[model samples]
Target: MSSVPITKHGAGLLKEELQRLKTKERPAVINAIAEARAHGDLSENADYDAAKERQGFIEGRIADLEGKLGAALIIDPTTLDADGRVVFAATVDLEDLESGEKVTYQIVGTDEADIKHAKVSVTSPIARAIIGKAAGDVVEVQAPSGGREYEILEVRYV
Candidate 1:
Protein backbone atom coordinates (compact mmCIF):
# COMPACT_ATOMS: atom_id res chain seq x y z
CA MET A 1 0.00 0.00 0.00
CA SER A 2 0.96 3.66 -0.35
CA SER A 3 2.35 5.67 2.54
CA VAL A 4 -0.40 7.34 4.57
CA PRO A 5 -0.15 10.83 6.06
CA ILE A 6 0.01 10.89 9.83
CA THR A 7 0.82 13.62 12.33
CA LYS A 8 3.82 13.21 14.63
CA HIS A 9 1.52 12.87 17.65
CA GLY A 10 -0.53 10.23 15.85
CA ALA A 11 2.58 8.28 15.00
CA GLY A 12 3.71 8.45 18.63
CA LEU A 13 0.34 7.15 19.80
CA LEU A 14 0.57 4.21 17.39
CA LYS A 15 4.08 3.42 18.57
CA GLU A 16 2.98 3.50 22.21
CA GLU A 17 0.10 1.12 21.48
CA LEU A 18 2.41 -1.23 19.59
CA GLN A 19 4.83 -1.27 22.51
CA ARG A 20 2.07 -1.99 25.02
CA LEU A 21 0.68 -4.79 22.90
CA LYS A 22 4.07 -6.41 22.38
CA THR A 23 5.37 -6.01 25.93
CA LYS A 24 2.16 -6.52 27.93
CA GLU A 25 -0.89 -7.79 26.03
CA ARG A 26 0.96 -10.34 23.94
CA PRO A 27 2.52 -11.95 27.01
CA ALA A 28 -0.76 -11.93 28.93
CA VAL A 29 -2.55 -13.64 26.07
CA ILE A 30 0.17 -16.23 25.76
CA ASN A 31 -0.02 -17.01 29.47
CA ALA A 32 -3.79 -17.30 29.31
CA ILE A 33 -3.54 -19.79 26.45
CA ALA A 34 -0.95 -21.86 28.26
CA GLU A 35 -2.97 -21.94 31.48
CA ALA A 36 -6.10 -22.92 29.58
CA ARG A 37 -4.20 -25.75 27.86
CA ALA A 38 -3.10 -27.07 31.27
CA HIS A 39 -6.75 -27.71 32.17
CA GLY A 40 -6.52 -31.20 30.53
CA ASP A 41 -9.51 -31.65 28.16
CA LEU A 42 -9.07 -29.51 25.02
CA SER A 43 -12.27 -30.69 23.25
CA GLU A 44 -14.85 -29.17 25.63
CA ASN A 45 -12.76 -26.41 27.22
CA ALA A 46 -14.49 -23.05 26.76
CA ASP A 47 -11.58 -21.34 28.45
CA TYR A 48 -9.15 -22.77 25.93
CA ASP A 49 -11.38 -21.79 23.00
CA ALA A 50 -11.85 -18.30 24.35
CA ALA A 51 -8.12 -17.89 24.96
CA LYS A 52 -7.33 -19.01 21.43
CA GLU A 53 -9.84 -16.55 20.00
CA ARG A 54 -8.40 -13.73 22.07
CA GLN A 55 -4.90 -14.68 20.96
CA GLY A 56 -5.97 -14.53 17.32
CA PHE A 57 -7.46 -11.06 17.78
CA ILE A 58 -4.38 -9.79 19.58
CA GLU A 59 -1.98 -11.13 16.96
CA GLY A 60 -4.08 -9.71 14.12
CA ARG A 61 -4.16 -6.29 15.72
CA ILE A 62 -0.41 -6.34 16.27
CA ALA A 63 0.22 -7.13 12.63
CA ASP A 64 -2.22 -4.46 11.48
CA LEU A 65 -0.62 -1.81 13.67
CA GLU A 66 2.85 -2.77 12.49
CA GLY A 67 1.81 -2.49 8.86
CA LYS A 68 0.21 0.92 9.41
CA LEU A 69 3.23 2.28 11.28
CA GLY A 70 5.55 0.97 8.58
CA ALA A 71 3.58 2.80 5.86
CA ALA A 72 3.01 6.02 7.79
CA LEU A 73 4.53 9.30 6.71
CA ILE A 74 4.68 11.22 9.95
CA ILE A 75 4.63 15.01 9.81
CA ASP A 76 4.62 17.70 12.49
CA PRO A 77 2.06 20.43 11.99
CA THR A 78 4.28 23.01 13.66
CA THR A 79 6.92 22.49 10.97
CA LEU A 80 4.49 23.01 8.07
CA ASP A 81 5.17 25.87 5.63
CA ALA A 82 1.92 25.96 3.67
CA ASP A 83 1.76 29.77 3.74
CA GLY A 84 -1.81 29.89 5.12
CA ARG A 85 -3.44 27.36 2.77
CA VAL A 86 -5.33 24.43 4.20
CA VAL A 87 -3.39 21.15 4.39
CA PHE A 88 -3.06 18.02 6.46
CA ALA A 89 -2.61 18.77 10.19
CA ALA A 90 -3.98 22.30 9.77
CA THR A 91 -6.48 23.36 12.44
CA VAL A 92 -9.15 25.45 10.75
CA ASP A 93 -12.01 27.57 12.03
CA LEU A 94 -15.01 27.59 9.74
CA GLU A 95 -18.29 29.47 9.60
CA ASP A 96 -21.47 27.92 8.26
CA LEU A 97 -22.71 30.28 5.58
CA GLU A 98 -26.38 29.43 6.08
CA SER A 99 -26.68 28.89 9.85
CA GLY A 100 -23.90 31.31 10.82
CA GLU A 101 -22.49 28.71 13.20
CA LYS A 102 -18.75 28.36 13.79
CA VAL A 103 -16.75 25.15 14.14
CA THR A 104 -13.13 24.10 14.21
CA TYR A 105 -11.50 20.94 12.86
CA GLN A 106 -8.01 19.60 12.39
CA ILE A 107 -7.28 17.68 9.22
CA VAL A 108 -5.82 14.32 10.26
CA GLY A 109 -5.39 10.76 9.10
CA THR A 110 -8.22 8.20 9.37
CA ASP A 111 -6.56 6.47 12.31
CA GLU A 112 -6.30 9.76 14.23
CA ALA A 113 -9.74 11.15 13.36
CA ASP A 114 -12.16 11.77 16.23
CA ILE A 115 -15.16 13.92 15.51
CA LYS A 116 -15.70 14.68 19.20
CA HIS A 117 -12.12 15.96 19.33
CA ALA A 118 -12.60 18.05 16.19
CA LYS A 119 -10.13 15.96 14.23
CA VAL A 120 -11.40 15.15 10.73
CA SER A 121 -10.04 12.52 8.38
CA VAL A 122 -8.15 13.77 5.37
CA THR A 123 -10.51 11.88 3.06
CA SER A 124 -13.62 13.45 4.56
CA PRO A 125 -15.67 15.71 2.32
CA ILE A 126 -15.01 18.84 4.34
CA ALA A 127 -11.28 18.23 4.38
CA ARG A 128 -11.17 17.55 0.66
CA ALA A 129 -13.15 20.71 -0.09
CA ILE A 130 -11.02 23.02 2.07
CA ILE A 131 -7.63 21.59 1.21
CA GLY A 132 -5.40 24.08 -0.62
CA LYS A 133 -7.82 26.87 0.40
CA ALA A 134 -6.99 29.84 2.62
CA ALA A 135 -8.88 32.04 5.03
CA GLY A 136 -11.75 33.96 3.39
CA ASP A 137 -12.30 31.16 0.89
CA VAL A 138 -15.79 29.69 0.72
CA VAL A 139 -16.14 25.98 0.13
CA GLU A 140 -19.13 23.84 -0.80
CA VAL A 141 -19.28 20.45 0.87
CA GLN A 142 -21.50 17.55 -0.14
CA ALA A 143 -23.26 16.50 3.00
CA PRO A 144 -25.97 13.95 3.60
CA SER A 145 -28.37 16.81 4.28
CA GLY A 146 -27.43 18.32 0.93
CA GLY A 147 -24.72 20.71 -0.17
CA ARG A 148 -23.55 23.12 2.53
CA GLU A 149 -21.41 26.22 2.27
CA TYR A 150 -18.71 27.11 4.76
CA GLU A 151 -16.36 30.05 4.90
CA ILE A 152 -12.85 29.61 6.16
CA LEU A 153 -12.27 31.97 9.05
CA GLU A 154 -8.84 31.03 10.31
CA VAL A 155 -6.08 28.45 9.88
CA ARG A 156 -3.47 27.40 12.42
CA TYR A 157 -0.54 25.06 11.93
CA VAL A 158 -0.95 23.71 15.41
Candidate 2:
Protein backbone atom coordinates (compact mmCIF):
# COMPACT_ATOMS: atom_id res chain seq x y z
CA MET A 1 0.00 0.00 0.00
CA SER A 2 1.06 3.60 -0.56
CA SER A 3 2.43 5.51 2.40
CA VAL A 4 -0.14 7.86 3.95
CA PRO A 5 1.00 11.18 5.39
CA ILE A 6 0.08 11.84 9.03
CA THR A 7 1.19 14.45 11.49
CA LYS A 8 3.32 13.25 14.41
CA HIS A 9 0.62 14.30 16.87
CA GLY A 10 -2.01 12.51 14.86
CA ALA A 11 0.08 9.36 14.81
CA GLY A 12 0.51 9.53 18.58
CA LEU A 13 -3.24 9.80 19.05
CA LEU A 14 -3.79 6.80 16.83
CA LYS A 15 -1.23 4.82 18.77
CA GLU A 16 -2.91 5.71 22.06
CA GLU A 17 -6.27 4.57 20.70
CA LEU A 18 -4.73 1.28 19.49
CA GLN A 19 -3.24 0.68 22.91
CA ARG A 20 -6.57 1.38 24.63
CA LEU A 21 -8.38 -1.00 22.32
CA LYS A 22 -5.86 -3.77 22.92
CA THR A 23 -5.42 -3.36 26.67
CA LYS A 24 -8.81 -2.20 27.84
CA GLU A 25 -11.67 -2.47 25.38
CA ARG A 26 -10.65 -5.78 23.89
CA PRO A 27 -10.39 -7.46 27.28
CA ALA A 28 -13.62 -5.91 28.57
CA VAL A 29 -15.53 -7.18 25.57
CA ILE A 30 -14.03 -10.63 25.94
CA ASN A 31 -15.19 -10.77 29.52
CA ALA A 32 -18.62 -9.54 28.56
CA ILE A 33 -18.86 -12.21 25.89
CA ALA A 34 -17.85 -14.87 28.35
CA GLU A 35 -20.46 -13.72 30.87
CA ALA A 36 -23.16 -13.67 28.18
CA ARG A 37 -22.25 -17.20 27.07
CA ALA A 38 -22.68 -18.46 30.63
CA HIS A 39 -26.29 -17.26 30.67
CA GLY A 40 -27.55 -20.50 29.06
CA ASP A 41 -29.13 -21.15 25.61
CA LEU A 42 -27.16 -19.22 22.96
CA SER A 43 -30.12 -19.10 20.51
CA GLU A 44 -32.31 -16.81 22.61
CA ASN A 45 -29.53 -14.90 24.33
CA ALA A 46 -29.82 -11.25 23.33
CA ASP A 47 -26.79 -10.33 25.43
CA TYR A 48 -24.69 -12.86 23.57
CA ASP A 49 -25.76 -11.48 20.20
CA ALA A 50 -25.12 -7.92 21.28
CA ALA A 51 -21.74 -8.79 22.71
CA LYS A 52 -20.81 -10.58 19.47
CA GLU A 53 -21.81 -7.59 17.39
CA ARG A 54 -19.80 -5.24 19.59
CA GLN A 55 -16.82 -7.55 19.39
CA GLY A 56 -17.05 -7.53 15.59
CA PHE A 57 -17.09 -3.74 15.50
CA ILE A 58 -14.14 -3.48 17.87
CA GLU A 59 -12.13 -5.99 15.86
CA GLY A 60 -12.85 -4.15 12.62
CA ARG A 61 -11.75 -0.84 14.10
CA ILE A 62 -8.57 -2.42 15.47
CA ALA A 63 -7.73 -3.80 12.03
CA ASP A 64 -8.40 -0.47 10.36
CA LEU A 65 -6.24 1.41 12.87
CA GLU A 66 -3.44 -1.12 12.50
CA GLY A 67 -3.46 -0.79 8.71
CA LYS A 68 -3.40 2.99 8.87
CA LEU A 69 -0.50 3.04 11.36
CA GLY A 70 1.44 0.52 9.32
CA ALA A 71 1.25 2.75 6.25
CA ALA A 72 1.64 6.07 8.05
CA LEU A 73 4.44 8.47 7.15
CA ILE A 74 4.47 10.60 10.29
CA ILE A 75 5.60 14.19 9.76
CA ASP A 76 6.35 16.63 12.54
CA PRO A 77 5.15 20.10 11.62
CA THR A 78 7.90 21.79 13.64
CA THR A 79 10.54 19.94 11.61
CA LEU A 80 9.13 20.97 8.23
CA ASP A 81 11.46 23.17 6.12
CA ALA A 82 8.86 24.57 3.75
CA ASP A 83 10.17 28.18 4.17
CA GLY A 84 6.82 29.82 5.07
CA ARG A 85 4.84 28.08 2.31
CA VAL A 86 1.60 26.24 2.96
CA VAL A 87 2.37 22.55 3.04
CA PHE A 88 1.01 19.42 4.72
CA ALA A 89 0.68 19.91 8.49
CA ALA A 90 1.29 23.66 8.23
CA THR A 91 -1.12 25.96 10.08
CA VAL A 92 -2.16 28.82 7.82
CA ASP A 93 -3.92 32.05 8.62
CA LEU A 94 -6.16 33.49 5.90
CA GLU A 95 -8.59 36.29 5.27
CA ASP A 96 -11.73 36.03 3.19
CA LEU A 97 -11.54 38.60 0.44
CA GLU A 98 -15.29 39.12 0.16
CA SER A 99 -16.37 38.93 3.81
CA GLY A 100 -13.16 40.21 5.35
CA GLU A 101 -13.38 37.39 7.88
CA LYS A 102 -10.26 35.70 9.12
CA VAL A 103 -9.69 32.01 9.81
CA THR A 104 -6.88 29.63 10.54
CA TYR A 105 -6.57 26.03 9.46
CA GLN A 106 -4.06 23.25 9.82
CA ILE A 107 -3.62 21.04 6.78
CA VAL A 108 -3.74 17.40 7.90
CA GLY A 109 -4.52 13.97 6.62
CA THR A 110 -8.12 12.88 6.14
CA ASP A 111 -8.07 10.76 9.29
CA GLU A 112 -7.08 13.76 11.40
CA ALA A 113 -9.27 16.41 9.77
CA ASP A 114 -11.73 18.02 12.15
CA ILE A 115 -13.55 21.14 11.04
CA LYS A 116 -14.51 22.00 14.61
CA HIS A 117 -10.81 22.23 15.43
CA ALA A 118 -9.89 24.11 12.23
CA LYS A 119 -8.00 21.14 10.88
CA VAL A 120 -8.59 20.49 7.18
CA SER A 121 -7.79 17.50 5.04
CA VAL A 122 -5.09 17.92 2.41
CA THR A 123 -7.62 16.96 -0.26
CA SER A 124 -9.96 19.79 0.76
CA PRO A 125 -10.47 22.54 -1.82
CA ILE A 126 -8.87 25.30 0.21
CA ALA A 127 -5.89 23.19 1.20
CA ARG A 128 -5.37 22.10 -2.41
CA ALA A 129 -5.50 25.69 -3.60
CA ILE A 130 -2.98 26.84 -1.01
CA ILE A 131 -0.51 23.96 -1.12
CA GLY A 132 3.02 25.18 -1.86
CA LYS A 133 1.76 28.80 -1.67
CA ALA A 134 3.58 31.31 0.52
CA ALA A 135 2.13 34.01 2.72
CA GLY A 136 0.55 36.98 0.87
CA ASP A 137 -0.60 34.67 -1.92
CA VAL A 138 -4.22 34.88 -3.03
CA VAL A 139 -5.93 31.57 -3.65
CA GLU A 140 -9.30 30.88 -5.21
CA VAL A 141 -11.16 27.90 -3.92
CA GLN A 142 -14.10 26.22 -5.66
CA ALA A 143 -16.62 25.48 -2.95
CA PRO A 144 -19.96 23.74 -3.33
CA SER A 145 -21.76 27.06 -2.96
CA GLY A 146 -19.48 29.10 -5.20
CA GLY A 147 -15.89 30.10 -5.82
CA ARG A 148 -14.31 32.11 -3.04
CA GLU A 149 -10.98 33.87 -2.67
CA TYR A 150 -8.71 33.97 0.35
CA GLU A 151 -5.49 35.81 1.00
CA ILE A 152 -2.84 33.99 2.97
CA LEU A 153 -1.75 36.09 5.90
CA GLU A 154 0.69 33.81 7.66
CA VAL A 155 1.99 30.26 7.63
CA ARG A 156 3.09 28.48 10.80
CA TYR A 157 4.67 25.10 11.21
CA VAL A 158 3.55 24.35 14.74
Candidate 3:
Protein backbone atom coordinates (compact mmCIF):
# COMPACT_ATOMS: atom_id res chain seq x y z
CA MET A 1 0.00 0.00 0.00
CA SER A 2 1.24 3.52 -0.75
CA SER A 3 2.11 5.79 2.12
CA VAL A 4 -0.79 8.02 3.19
CA PRO A 5 0.08 11.70 3.37
CA ILE A 6 -1.38 13.42 6.44
CA THR A 7 -0.71 16.52 8.44
CA LYS A 8 0.65 16.17 11.98
CA HIS A 9 -2.68 17.33 13.34
CA GLY A 10 -4.65 14.82 11.32
CA ALA A 11 -2.36 11.99 12.38
CA GLY A 12 -2.79 12.96 15.99
CA LEU A 13 -6.56 12.97 15.66
CA LEU A 14 -6.52 9.50 14.14
CA LYS A 15 -4.28 8.21 16.86
CA GLU A 16 -6.55 9.67 19.50
CA GLU A 17 -9.59 8.06 17.93
CA LEU A 18 -7.81 4.73 17.78
CA GLN A 19 -6.95 4.99 21.44
CA ARG A 20 -10.50 5.85 22.41
CA LEU A 21 -11.92 2.97 20.43
CA LYS A 22 -9.51 0.47 21.88
CA THR A 23 -9.60 1.52 25.51
CA LYS A 24 -13.11 2.82 25.97
CA GLU A 25 -15.40 1.57 23.21
CA ARG A 26 -13.87 -1.87 23.02
CA PRO A 27 -14.36 -2.55 26.72
CA ALA A 28 -17.87 -1.11 26.80
CA VAL A 29 -18.95 -3.27 23.87
CA ILE A 30 -17.40 -6.34 25.44
CA ASN A 31 -19.37 -5.75 28.63
CA ALA A 32 -22.52 -5.11 26.66
CA ILE A 33 -22.10 -8.37 24.74
CA ALA A 34 -21.56 -10.27 27.98
CA GLU A 35 -24.67 -8.72 29.52
CA ALA A 36 -26.71 -9.43 26.42
CA ARG A 37 -25.58 -13.05 26.45
CA ALA A 38 -27.03 -13.37 29.97
CA HIS A 39 -30.50 -12.52 28.62
CA GLY A 40 -31.20 -16.19 27.75
CA ASP A 41 -31.68 -17.73 24.27
CA LEU A 42 -28.98 -16.36 21.88
CA SER A 43 -31.08 -17.11 18.79
CA GLU A 44 -33.85 -14.61 19.47
CA ASN A 45 -31.87 -12.06 21.47
CA ALA A 46 -32.05 -8.75 19.67
CA ASP A 47 -29.64 -7.13 22.15
CA TYR A 48 -27.03 -9.79 21.46
CA ASP A 49 -27.32 -9.37 17.71
CA ALA A 50 -27.10 -5.60 17.94
CA ALA A 51 -24.09 -5.76 20.26
CA LYS A 52 -22.35 -8.22 17.94
CA GLU A 53 -22.94 -5.98 14.96
CA ARG A 54 -21.66 -2.97 16.85
CA GLN A 55 -18.60 -4.95 17.87
CA GLY A 56 -17.88 -5.86 14.28
CA PHE A 57 -18.08 -2.25 13.19
CA ILE A 58 -15.83 -1.08 16.03
CA GLU A 59 -13.29 -3.78 15.36
CA GLY A 60 -13.24 -3.00 11.64
CA ARG A 61 -12.73 0.67 12.32
CA ILE A 62 -9.95 -0.11 14.77
CA ALA A 63 -8.16 -2.22 12.16
CA ASP A 64 -8.57 0.46 9.53
CA LEU A 65 -7.19 3.13 11.84
CA GLU A 66 -4.24 0.94 12.74
CA GLY A 67 -3.42 0.31 9.10
CA LYS A 68 -3.68 3.98 8.22
CA LEU A 69 -1.50 4.98 11.15
CA GLY A 70 1.11 2.43 10.13
CA ALA A 71 1.20 3.80 6.59
CA ALA A 72 0.90 7.47 7.48
CA LEU A 73 3.51 10.07 6.55
CA ILE A 74 2.80 12.99 8.82
CA ILE A 75 3.90 16.43 7.67
CA ASP A 76 3.90 19.54 9.83
CA PRO A 77 2.99 22.63 7.85
CA THR A 78 4.77 25.00 10.21
CA THR A 79 8.10 23.27 9.55
CA LEU A 80 7.89 23.42 5.77
CA ASP A 81 9.95 25.87 3.70
CA ALA A 82 9.02 25.46 0.06
CA ASP A 83 9.88 29.06 -0.78
CA GLY A 84 6.63 30.52 -2.20
CA ARG A 85 5.26 27.54 -4.06
CA VAL A 86 1.97 25.98 -3.00
CA VAL A 87 2.27 22.44 -1.72
CA PHE A 88 0.54 19.95 0.52
CA ALA A 89 -0.12 21.48 3.96
CA ALA A 90 0.09 24.97 2.48
CA THR A 91 -2.55 27.55 3.40
CA VAL A 92 -3.36 29.57 0.32
CA ASP A 93 -5.33 32.76 -0.07
CA LEU A 94 -7.13 33.03 -3.38
CA GLU A 95 -9.34 35.49 -5.22
CA ASP A 96 -12.11 34.12 -7.43
CA LEU A 97 -11.74 35.76 -10.83
CA GLU A 98 -15.43 35.59 -11.68
CA SER A 99 -17.07 36.42 -8.36
CA GLY A 100 -14.20 38.49 -6.97
CA GLU A 101 -14.61 36.68 -3.69
CA LYS A 102 -11.56 35.98 -1.53
CA VAL A 103 -11.17 32.69 0.28
CA THR A 104 -8.48 30.65 1.94
CA TYR A 105 -7.85 26.93 1.92
CA GLN A 106 -5.32 24.61 3.44
CA ILE A 107 -4.31 21.65 1.31
CA VAL A 108 -4.57 18.54 3.47
CA GLY A 109 -4.96 14.80 3.22
CA THR A 110 -8.25 13.24 2.15
CA ASP A 111 -9.03 12.21 5.76
CA GLU A 112 -8.73 15.83 6.83
CA ALA A 113 -10.56 17.49 3.97
CA ASP A 114 -13.34 19.63 5.44
CA ILE A 115 -14.58 22.45 3.27
CA LYS A 116 -16.43 23.96 6.20
CA HIS A 117 -13.11 24.29 7.95
CA ALA A 118 -11.31 25.58 4.85
CA LYS A 119 -9.26 22.43 4.44
CA VAL A 120 -9.11 20.87 0.98
CA SER A 121 -7.79 17.50 -0.06
CA VAL A 122 -4.55 17.43 -2.03
CA THR A 123 -6.31 15.37 -4.69
CA SER A 124 -9.11 17.90 -5.14
CA PRO A 125 -9.29 19.74 -8.47
CA ILE A 126 -8.59 23.16 -7.03
CA ALA A 127 -5.73 21.94 -4.90
CA ARG A 128 -4.22 20.04 -7.83
CA ALA A 129 -4.31 23.16 -9.99
CA ILE A 130 -2.63 25.28 -7.32
CA ILE A 131 -0.09 22.76 -6.03
CA GLY A 132 2.97 24.14 -7.76
CA LYS A 133 1.81 27.71 -8.13
CA ALA A 134 3.16 30.74 -6.32
CA ALA A 135 1.62 34.01 -5.22
CA GLY A 136 0.13 36.15 -8.01
CA ASP A 137 -0.37 33.13 -10.28
CA VAL A 138 -3.76 32.39 -11.82
CA VAL A 139 -4.94 28.80 -11.76
CA GLU A 140 -7.86 27.30 -13.62
CA VAL A 141 -9.78 24.68 -11.65
CA GLN A 142 -12.30 22.19 -13.02
CA ALA A 143 -14.93 22.68 -10.36
CA PRO A 144 -18.30 20.97 -10.17
CA SER A 145 -19.99 24.12 -11.46
CA GLY A 146 -17.57 24.57 -14.33
CA GLY A 147 -14.09 25.77 -15.10
CA ARG A 148 -13.24 28.55 -12.66
CA GLU A 149 -10.15 30.71 -12.42
CA TYR A 150 -8.61 31.84 -9.19
CA GLU A 151 -5.69 34.18 -8.60
CA ILE A 152 -3.29 33.23 -5.87
CA LEU A 153 -2.87 36.04 -3.40
CA GLU A 154 -0.61 34.52 -0.75
CA VAL A 155 0.84 31.25 0.46
CA ARG A 156 1.62 30.49 4.08
CA TYR A 157 2.95 27.47 5.88
CA VAL A 158 0.48 27.82 8.75
Position 76, candidate 3: lDDT: 98
Lowest-scoring 10 consecutive residues by lDDT in candidate 3? 139-148
In terms of TM-score, which candidate is stronger, 1 or 2?
Answer: 2
RMSD of each: 0.7, 0.5, 0.6
Expressed as tens digits, the lDDT of each residue in 31-140 for candidate 3 is 99999999989999999999999999999999999999999999999999999999999999999999999999999999989999999999999999999999999999
Sort by lDDT, best first.
3, 2, 1
| lDDT digits (tens) for residues 37-150 of candidate 1 | 899999999998998998898899999999999999998999999999999999999999999999999999999999999999999999999999999999999977899999
What is the Cα-based lDDT of residue 59 in candidate 3? 100
Q: TM-score each candidate.
A: 0.98, 0.99, 0.98
**List of clashing residue pairs for candidate 3:** none
- Residue pairs with colliding backbones in model 1 are none
Error of 1 at 76 (Å): 0.5
Off by over 4 Å in 2: none
Error of 3 at 128 (Å): 0.4
